[model samples]
Target: MLDKRRNSNSKERIDLINRFIGLFGKQVIQSVAADREFVGKNRLAFLNRNEIRYYIRIRNNFKVFLPQKNKEIKASHLFNCFKTNQFVYYNKIVRINEQLCYLSGCKLNSKNIKQDFLIIVSFNKPENAQEEYQKRWQIEMYFKAMKSSVFDIEKTYLQDIQRIEKLILLVMIAFILCYKIGIYLHQINPITIKKHGRKAEVFLNMG
Candidate 1:
């Protein structure tokens, strides 16, 4: 998933995903959650074709066809149609690039007019989609910890990509060890995180 060449376009993204699948096999992956930048019609189709459950964040301006309402509308417009703090969902087939696929949207939290500021498109029910998408944040946090919070990976003087990747691997191993130690400490002390206002990972790493 590391590419310095900036081959991050939709085609390259799909190719990388397929390559991972080829290496690990489909059973290794259960579901996927990605940011809006990694989502498009073709990419969704690729995930769908492989029967991988995915929840992808969509831009507010992303177009979706609502057959129930018999109209095309932007994702933001759909949000405005709902009341604040209300749980709502729409299940329909959305057309993208002449291809039609199932689209589901769920509102996680609500604003004054738009109930769902963070909209997710998925094949699963909207009720659970946001919860699943939240899992992706763990990966984001891990990367953040590696880059600056703990490892400061960006400060590396090495220019070689291979060496950089190896350094990242070492960092990952160290992170895993720290997390395991953290888990063990948590199990022994059983401290409630709400009281200390410090994350278990941070507290454990400090130990």
Candidate 2:
């Protein structure tokens, strides 16, 4: 991972994407998904030019251009008509700069009138875009495990940045091992806490 004072620059992020393509080849770089942090005109254009499908989340305040209706719309305005767990799609090509994308909005977990919404801008209408967007949380959980749940890497007092990075790498390896063990134990017994679709596969910590 590229780190610049704990934050990655746009060039670093792009280089990482290019590195992934170089290592795995174009065919393997089918699609890349990221949250709003990765959203930018250059990044989106780069992915589009390279024909790499991307499902990047957009902030509600981002402006979107509707090609079909010949009008501009704020991402937040797209959600006004949606209900909880309801997905609204704009399959017609939309413009962000000169780059074209498909826009999708979802009102998630709406039962409590909570303002949970998602905006996805993608290349073409990627199948199951909402499901794909949800996968971002899996990466988040990995970081959570590395920092607090299992490895507790955040409590370390290492002074050298390089050493801290290496230590975190080691903790990452340990987290992977623990995850494997957790999955194995889950398969052996399959005890689930929640009955809903989202939480059905969540297994109790094997540790």
Candidate 3:
């Protein structure tokens, strides 16, 4: 019983560490965890630690809150919560790089003052974020294919609950079939196909 309890505690500690590692990269994780100041603050403020200074930007939705805080505080403050909270620093005016440009114009809603200002946050490590964001797209694509193509989810002629359950089962089976076929095709070797083609050619020549 004691051994089992120890193992459970160990696993819990490891899970906590891993969660920190995921939020802040391994190098920063130890520093962030050891820093009591960061841990004590609100989790939303701690999210800023996940971002690097050079890669920080804020959205236009944040502009209203900005004026209420500090004028000199830059968009970087959104991702630098420690600085923002400590110094009461809010907005920092930054020059947009003309060479590394973003869209200059945005359509603003006349009724909403918030919609008028749009802030673009560019990251120095865009490639890192790009791959992670692409994984989300792949997941969305799979869900779309499952719902529309394999499942025929929209063609639900069944109004009854029991009939709806049957439709769901049919859709699941279709999705599994498609997934298995895709896996099998991906495993096939081009070299084996080429070798078979050569053997067939030789057989034809002999014939």
Candidate 4:
């Protein structure tokens, strides 16, 4: 990963994306998904220009242009008529930072409506955008395992990029091994899902 004292610049992020796309070739990759951190004008434009599908979450207050209605508005305002548990999707297109994107969102099932909402911008399959976004959980879990649950890599606090990458590589290898074992065990005994479609524990973990 590209790292700076603060957030890595857009160029570095784009370069890293280029490196991975080059390595895998665009055809093999289905789509890329990320949170708001990766949702920027240049990056979204690059992905769209390259014909790579992306599902990225955006802030509720983020501004977007409605090509059909011909007006710019806050992302949440698009769903002004939507109620809790109701989803609103602009399947045609929504312009964010001048990049055309499909928008989908829903208000959370809680009383704090203003504080809880999920808005996603995507290139394809607006109906499945939220489901596609769920894939990011695996990456999040991996990061948590590397930092605290398993390897505790953050405790070392390696500042140098090379050293940090090396440590991550080593922990990554171990994580993969554990992941394989977790899969094997899961196949034999399957993870139980609760009423909410979630397992009490990570079905796949550093076991």
The candidate scoring highest on lDDT is 4
- Computed on alpha carbons, the lDDT of every model, listed in order, comes to 0.71, 0.77, 0.37, 0.82
Candidate rank order under TM-score: 4, 2, 1, 3
* TM per prediction: 0.81, 0.85, 0.31, 0.88
* Cα error, candidate 2, residue 41 (Å): 0.9
Please identify model 4 stretches exceeding 4 Å from their true place.
1-3, 110-113, 157-160, 192-198, 203-207
* Regions of model 3 farther than 4 Å from truth: 1-128, 160-166, 189-207
**Candidate 1 residue-wise lDDT at 119:** 69
lDDT of 2 by residue, 1-207 (tens): 443457676677788888887898889765688998788888888888888888899887788888778898787677768776678786577887568888887776645654667888889764467877778788989877776565677788887878988897887787788779878887898756675545565433433
Sorted on lDDT, best first, the list reads: 4, 2, 1, 3
Instruction: Decide which is better by lDDT, 2 or 3.
Output: 2
- Report the error of model 1 at residue 105, Å: 4.9
Candidate 1, overall lDDT? Answer: 0.71
Question: Looking at model 1, which ten-residue stretch has the lowest summed lDDT?
Answer: 198-207
For candidate 3, what is the total of clashing residue pairs?
A: 6
Pairs with backbone N, CA or C atoms under 3 Å apart (clashes), candidate 2: none
lDDT of 1 by residue, 132-156 (tens): 8889998887887787677787888
Cα displacement (Å) at residue 199, model 1: 4.7
Measured with C-alpha atoms, the lDDT of residue 136 in candidate 3 is 41
lDDT of 3 by residue, 1-207 (tens): 122322334344445656767897666531211111111122322333443222222343332223334343433334343321122222233323211211111232346543332233222333233233234444454566655544447666767777777877776676667667655665683223464464221111110
What's the true lDDT of residue 57 in model 2?
A: 90
lDDT of 4: 0.82
All candidates: CA RMSD in angstroms?
3.4, 2.9, 17.2, 2.4
Per-residue lDDT over 87-132 for candidate 4, one digit per residue giving the tens place of the 0 to 100 score = 7687678789989889998877767635567888988788988788
Supply the global lDDT for candidate 3: 0.37
- Candidate 1 Cα outliers beyond 4 Å, as residue runs: 1-7, 83-87, 96-116, 195-207
